[model samples]
Target: MSTSFTHIFNGDSTAEAYAHSGLEGQEFVWREMVVQGPSKGIPGQESFFGPRRTYFQKELGMSAESYYSLTEEEWHRMAGASRRGEWVLWYEYDVFCQFNLIALLAGIHYWDNPPDRLSLICVGEDENHRWNTLANFSPDQYPKLLDTRKGLTHDDLLYAATVWEAFIQKAPLGLLPFAQTPHPSFPYLGLAIGYYLRQFPQAHNGLNTLEDILLQEIAQSPKTQPQLIRQVLLQRNHPFGFGDLQWMWYMKKLQPLWLQEDDHLSLTNLGKKVLEGDTVYREHLAGRHFGGATALDYIWEEDREEIRPFPEK
Candidate 1:
């Protein structure tokens, strides 16, 4: 009832890390993998969450009730109990958190009592430019991060809301302009757009950026699950914000292109061809939704710097 600010953390990990920071305010720990499923529609609403529900159930084995309780309930509860104070969003610079960030920004516009003041604490690298996470930092370091929080103005949120709507509508070309010059309130916004665009299937091989990277790593040698994950995470060219659970799902979808022997995985001949651009991986793949569009709805060519529509066969 008497707090100066409300803190919105990216997930449980970030929240847990700052629980003892001695800051007094309402704490909202965001819970959702916005990067893994259909991201269209008004966030926090079940209507737009149908595809996400199935995605989680099939890929992560999470039940509908579990998903609802984990996401919508917490999201709504936070807004319902919102106090009149500066709302601070603690996120990461990676695409995963950025995806959630924009969606949350857009969703806030529909809240019965939206935040009067919006601020953000986003961390990705330290002074030496070393990659780090909130959880990776010691508890004492939280205050320093809090001190660097950037306040977002009304125009900033408006832009973010617009971007989310455009993304959900599957008009990606409209978003390309922002990938280079993002709004000042969110410097990472443009970077997030670039990162996400890279994930679209390549025009040549039909393999997405991350998938191609995975295949290349696998081709180096038969790799145990842990080794592969570790290598991917450490690679400088690794997909920004791509996580273990997402990789697991990708492996499941790409089983046909890989040979799994016991705990190790190696690329099959099909995988080699797909990786090399000799095969169109998407042709053999099942339909997959990304936000409002299916996987094959567009092809992103890195060299061409374009995301053009791909005619479905």
Candidate 2:
């Protein structure tokens, strides 16, 4: 029935790799960044894509037509794939891919009928605890990777829907239980969601985990944007699988805290103060959005690993 097998890849690069690997499945690249922008309500609706289109246009300069053609169309195909044939989703263990995976699972959970099978090939670290890249693997290794794919259960689908619902709502803490308890089928999900929760500003330095690392790294080794992005990829590897585009957005947002001298970046006095806990970088939250909620609405308490509503200034 349908095309026997449909492989949904996390991105174009991954999809391209699978193509060269001689896989016999129809390839579909999931090109959306659901990790960013608004996703509070039902994900597939036009309302969900409105703020998403605006955000992408403002931040990445992607046009509304391009958003529909490039991103929205892919999602519709992914929906139809459930009834088409057995599908194998190829994604990684990073926060970027995890959010995408959760959203995809949520979409599938609500689909009309289950196909012959649904599976996942989520790559993570190796025995030495180093990051593994499936795309970097040799063509011969592709078959072995496919063998590692885990079939999904109805409960797993429900879990992803529940996690996604909490994610798009003002319910970051609700994700903790799922983060604490790892699902057998979704090994890397717990760790990824844990990273997501820590995105709120930490109490110690008023910087989120990623923001603190980014600033701290920049302070240690001042570099140009390109150099800084390259360094961040190496430093924040594995579960942090952020690329240049994500880094560009973050670097732009931290402009007030960093000084750009001849295209190189370093912390400003205010940035230093914020880093040392002398000042709170509340200004960083001025126009920041974390999913459906404004980032300013919550402060992260590291010791408790929870976000508390930030008192209004």
Candidate 3:
């Protein structure tokens, strides 16, 4: 008789790696949802997925049917697993996975009776510091991780619930207080919230942190788009698990400030000025960003050092 364990993975890549890890009699569930989209965090209360589906299709130009095909099914599987098996959550210590982790915990809180045994295996760094993601680890490394899994506590679930509520609220300012305080259950939550704050336009340059990184990197040395992206990812200490597609979207938005000569991309005079803090980019180049229940046209006010909504036209 083989032992059975329920493994809930953060994404497809990690789940695929674990599927081939020779773990026996294990039920694998991939949490395919991304909380980066517009949401109300009211998963079961009302249907929030419809607006999210529309946002991906209309704003991001993603195929709605393709992206959200199995999400409902996977979520159902995860909830069901909690009732019957020793379940483990496999996530990383970045904003992307952390957001998902909190959302999952919030969902589990609604359960009449949660899992009998719940364990978590969250990997941030390995011995060499080269592997930041579980998908990057070898099969042999997984067994050791499985052995060291920590049990999830009630305090952890409560913390997640609080954070998830803040994340989905219309006003992101609610997160400021939470980010300032440290929670023992979630050591990385504060840092992750810091990163999330940087996602708003920077007051000085009017560029988000990711955009700033991209412009600075290209300005340092002109490189192809793929090369620049890889460099950015390599140097990133707190990656938000952005894929190539999302990177491409940001690059497309910044195209006006870049001069693509041959296959290489370089910054324009305006881009350079924007980077040097001589001029703001948001006034001319401001774009839309969705936060939970709010659709915002915002600019980072340098003097105030806060994100302010664009005045209504």
Q: Of the candidates shown, which would achieve the greatest lDDT relative to the real structure?
A: 2
The sequence of per-residue lDDT tens digits that candidate 2 reaches over residues 193-288 is: 778767778887778888887888888987988888787787565466777888788877788889998988899998999888898877767766
Weakest ten-residue segment in model 2 by summed lDDT:
36-45
For all candidates, the clash counts are: 0, 0, 0
User: Candidate 1: TM-score?
Assistant: 0.92
lDDT tens digits, residue span 134-158, model 1: 7677777888888899988767777
- lDDT sort, best first: 2, 1, 3
Question: What lDDT is reached at residue 149 by model 2?
Answer: 86
In candidate 2, stretches whose alpha carbon ends up further than 4 angstroms from where it belongs are 1-3
Q: Model 2 residue 73 lDDT?
A: 85
| Residue 198 lDDT in candidate 2 | 77
The models' CA-based lDDT, in order, is: 0.78, 0.79, 0.70
Give me the runs in candidate 3 sitting further than 4 Å from their true place.
1-3, 25-35, 44-46, 125-131, 283-287, 293-313
**TM per candidate:** 0.92, 0.92, 0.85
lDDT of 1 at 170: 63
